[model samples]
Target: MGVKNRIFKYYFPQKAVDLKQKRRGNCNGIVLMYHEVLEDSIDIPAWTIVKRSNFEWQMKYLRNNFDVVTMDEATKRVCGLSEGQRPFAVVTFDDGYKGNFNNVLPVMNKLSLPFVVYVATKAVSDSSIYWYDKIIGLLDKRDDLFISIEGDDIPIRKSHSNSKRWSLMQKALSKLKSMSASERDIEVKKILDENDARSFSSRIGMLSASDLGAMSKHQLVTIGNHTHGHELLDQISGLEIYNTINKANCLIESWTGIKPKHFAYPNGNYSENVLDALSAFGFSTLVTTKPGIWDGSRSLMEIPRLGIGRFETKSQFKARLAGFL
Candidate 1:
């Protein structure tokens, strides 16, 4: 660990955390956001992939330290319809990664913990990979020194470590996220095909319909909609946002036999129209990528969540839950 982490791990005592929690009382709870959970041996070092061991530690910590609840129960707590222990924690996974089914479900099930998995429907049904993953794969496997997208040629660096490659991918994703979904797909496909990057299998691809079905059946798992195309609702037209969400809900209901009552904004982007569309669709709560505790002061439609994954150390995780980071 680095110097900062050393302090958080060895020096940041529990008494300090207790004081912080006590000072920040009456907050509704905290909702944690995660993406992929993989074994520690996995070579992919993306920010979204939390190693299985680390994930287990975090989940166990939540189970012991906080009242871990499902999305529905969290909503009830948000609305004062039900009561629960203070500093509630809600675990959620986004992008419907197969890791969630293969890795996360077993851990949560073993601990008898509840969580929400938001499925981006098209990826699940079409058996296709997420655009961001494709970008990472293409960049990591590229043989050329540089690649050209549209008319712009971006330099590719020879990296001694995964960190350098990840840096390149982050820059690429920043540009991609600004574009429309179709435009982003076109760019992603160009890079993947030109470099002959293979699509990922069940190891990293989105969950299959059967996977969602099986997971939803677990009493501790709650299936939620994450839009059909995983498009950024704030960037798209109102009609497109409505259609994507509506279509996703139908497909998810078909697979899980349960109509999803909650929705997570893809890329954590939303607008007034997006919120209105979700309300019209009868979604109970909407989760965003905004970081902070859900203190019941925010609208149910604008619920904030702290994104957690590989980048966070155990001490940092403790501090995050305690609202220190």
Candidate 2:
């Protein structure tokens, strides 16, 4: 094991014990969220990616020290059902990265652990890459681009680097949201071409239809809808949001031969209308990016999750998982 992995292994168990003690009777269960399981390098911001080694170490810790369960079982137990059940954890990944199938699933299989992956179905069919990836790639290559939003121009500076680009991208995307769909598409296309990101295909290595089908067959893996295009529901109309999520659910069902029961909001920011729309669609549970423990008494629509990413050390990982930080 590397230094980080060794350190994490040593501290993770103690952190879990401390968290368990802190929560006492109030501790329900933990819903762990992951994005990409990178082999050695994760190019994204530190807060958004976790290395494969760390992930494996974390899973091993769970296997040794906690009863890890599926999202459905954890939800049921939290809801006062499944009496006499022991404390457990649920593992979930968002944005169905191709890496999940390539890197995450193997580890999961080795550990015989159950996990849920929330996939953005639109990307499965699109040849182009996700816009966020394009943005990141652009920022990585060009440091001199000035992103203008509503007449305010922000130059990408080297000192702030990733943070500045992320903020600017958010502002730019918000501006795009205000435009009509066709207009937004035109604007995005222009941005991508200008950034020389047109050659980068987001779907180049993503999970194919067959891959999803095979994954769904595993009893340990459950698929969930993350929307058609992974749009931020709070920024879009209720009808658009509903259609996106519903479409993803349909596509996943067509591929997997099973209708997904769970939904995770893209970006995990939803308005009241989005929640109502989900309820209307007969969704039993939804996951959010907000961080907190799962209590049965909370709203089924606003489930919070602790995000794991590249910057997390083993100590930090344990601290976050144990609810210590």
lDDT of 1 by residue, 1-325 (tens): 4566556764455676667666655337889999999878775657788899999999998887778988878777777788765657899999899899989999998999999999899988899977787766554343443556667776656553555556666777788788777887788878766666654332467799999989888999999989998888888788888899889989999998999999899989987877776778888888999998787688888889998867677778887777767
TM-score of each: 0.90, 0.82
Cα lDDT of candidate 2 equals 0.74
- For candidate 1, the 10 contiguous residues with the lowest summed lDDT are 138-147
lDDT of 2 by residue, 159-250 (tens): 66554456665666667767766676776677766656655433224577878999999999999989989887887887888789889988
Clashing pairs in 2: 49-309, 49-310, 129-202
- Candidate 2: which stretches are off by over 4 Å? 1-16, 19-22, 41-46, 83-86, 139-146, 151-187, 199-205
In order, the Cα lDDT scores of the candidates are 0.80, 0.74
* True-structure RMSD for candidate 1: 2.9
